[model samples]
Target: MIPVLFLSTVLIWGTTWLAIALQAGPVPVLVSVFYRFALAGILFLFILAVTGRLRLPKREHQVWLVAQALCLFSLNFICFYHAVHYIPSGLESLIFSLSTIFNALNARIFYGERISGKVILASLLGISGLVLLFGRDILDADASGTLTGVGLAMLGTLFFSLGNMVSRRNSREGISPVFANAWAMSYGAIVLMLLIILTGTPLIAPPDATYLGALLYLAAIGSIVGFSTYLILVARIGSARAAYATVLFPIIALGLSTVFEGYVWHWTGFVGLGLALLGNIVIFAPSRRPRRTAPIAKDAETVASS
Candidate 1:
């Protein structure tokens, strides 16, 4: 189940960036995001209804759920899609790899989880690699747009990290990840819809086939299925571990970008890739000590009988 969830996240997110890339022209970024989650929310709600799995949460949980949706479903994509126009998609993905670092820090902040030395060192390595990765571009070019892109990417990552924290909290409260994800998505869709209307952004109608295809991919595969699995992974594996998928999935996105978008890499990019992998290892490496098991006690059984 773990491996399957990991691979599913990688594949779905890997390809979805290309779909986002497709929406770049003739539409407001918010409109693109609005269309995506609105459709995705509807699809998820429909699936829940058909499967009889959708249940409304208690009133008290609504606020956190909405915040999760705004962070993950709305702002995360808004920042990312806009960022890519400034930074190369590969560089954006690399920036996104920092999400694991952000998630670890957020876990510390929200849950009082101890920050491991290994995790901090890993974050430094990853940041250094990113410096190397963007060395030429940053040094040679004005980089006004690119720097802005990097900033927005980081902002998007922060929102994603916050969402992870919320999901983790909800999980601890015994809420199913799916239930949390479903409601959050609905809230996000509503927010996006309001943004679209207020902005008066005219939605672009692509070729009938292409637009529909992109919508379906983003809505069903990318948003609903991919996000649901990711939430489950966060609940099960700890957000720090599950966020490793962000690091791996971008490799897939970078590959696709190279082939389809003619993204050429320099020596620095390879070095950055190595460092990113190392950082991922550091962040997720298991502790050395084995967990102790309780010894079976015969007296405990006697007490139970009594």
Candidate 2:
């Protein structure tokens, strides 16, 4: 089951980057993202309504839900899309993968979760590998603008971590993850729409079939279906385990790059990919022994009485 979900996410996400690469012209990256989610949100809501699954979340859940939408659905894409303008997508993806470390840290800080030594060591190894893989890109003078773009991707990851926590909080209250996500996407779309209108960004008529095709793919497959699968995995396994998929998806992205963009991986990139994969494995591996459960001693008096 895990493998199925992981592979599905990897394939969908892997190919989606191609669609993103096709986006051209002065259409602000944010506007492109706005269109993706707004259209996706509407379609998702329509599906939900048709299936008798749509409804408003409680007022108390609204703020965090909206925050999740902004973080996961909106600004995250804005950051990544705009970042691609300056950075090689491969290098950008390497930076984006740091979300694993950020997620672990955030969980520890906010939830009092213990950070295991294995997890820390694995994360360090993976990061080091990524640095090696993209070291040239990182050091190149031509990549200066991309340095800031990488920073934005990191910020996007932080927002995504926040969104994860928000979703967890919602689930703890007995709201279904799917329900929360649907609402979050809706709110995210609304926020993006408002931003678009306020900025007076010209929504040019569909430029061509290529743009329309890309937009539809992003809206349906990327936003709605990909997210829905992720949420389901989160519910089925656990958040941290589900997040391990993040480890695999980037490799898939790299594979796609190689096939379509003529990406030629050096030895360093291979080493980096290996290290990152090992880190993911170590992070998600089950403990040697379940944390020992203390046995409850039976009272002699109670036994005698019985």
Candidate 3:
């Protein structure tokens, strides 16, 4: 079950980058984001209703749900869509991969979870690998634009990490991930709609098949299926471990970029990919410790003898 969820998340989210790239023209980016969650929210609600699985969150859960929506579904994507305008899709993905580190840090701060030395080492290796992969782009690109994109990507990653914390809290509260996600997505869509109205970004749909197709794919597979599985992983595993999916998915996204976006692969990029994958292994490698057994009491042993 764990392997299935992990691999499915990597494959689904990895491909979603190309779909997001296809979402680039005509329609407002914010509006496109709005449309995605709105449609996904509707679908999730309908399915839950039909299955009799929809749940109403308690008052306390409602607040966290709203915060989760803003962080995960709203501001994070808003930053990401804008960030990708200035960076290649692969670079954008590499930056987003930092979520593993962010998740560890945020989990420690919010949940008081101890960070293992291996996790920290893994994060360092991952960061170094990303630097190797995109170091040339950072040096060669327009300074202001590159900085803006990197900053936005980092900000988006932070929000994503914060959302994971909220998801952890929701899990502790015994809320089903699917139920929480449906409400969070609905709230996120509502927030985006209000933003569109306020910004006066015309809610016009693009006529191109590419854009519409990408939107549907993102809404159905990416937003609904991908997020549901991911949050479920968060519930089953720790958020820090679950977020390793981001670390792994970028490799797939980079591969797609090579095919579709003419991303030239350097030798260093291959080395970097290997190191990043190695980091994932290090982070998830199980710790070895002998299980302690309870010592039998003398009285209990004597009773058994009698």
Compare the candidates by lDDT and give the number of the best one: 3
Model 3, span 113-225: residue lDDT tens: 89989888888777778777776766666666888888899999999999999998998998888999999999999999999999999998766888889989999999999
In candidate 3, where is summed lDDT lowest over 10 consecutive residues?
290-299
- Candidate 2 per-residue lDDT, tens place, 72-158, comes to 898888788877777776677777767667777777877777777876777687777777776766776245586687787788777
Best to worst by lDDT, what's the order?
A: 3, 1, 2
Runs in model 2 deviating more than 4 A are 141-143, 236-238, 290-306
Ranking by TM-score: 3, 2, 1
lDDT agreement of model 1 with the native: 0.80
Candidate 3 accuracy as lDDT: 0.88
lDDT of 2: 0.75
Worst 10 residues of 1 by lDDT: 133-142
Q: Which lDDT value does model 2 have at 201? A: 78
Which residue pairs collide, candidate 1? none
Instruction: Tell how far residue 272 is off in model 2, in angstroms.
Output: 2.0
Taking all chains together, the TM-score of candidate 3 against the true structure is 0.92
Candidate number of the best TM-score? 3
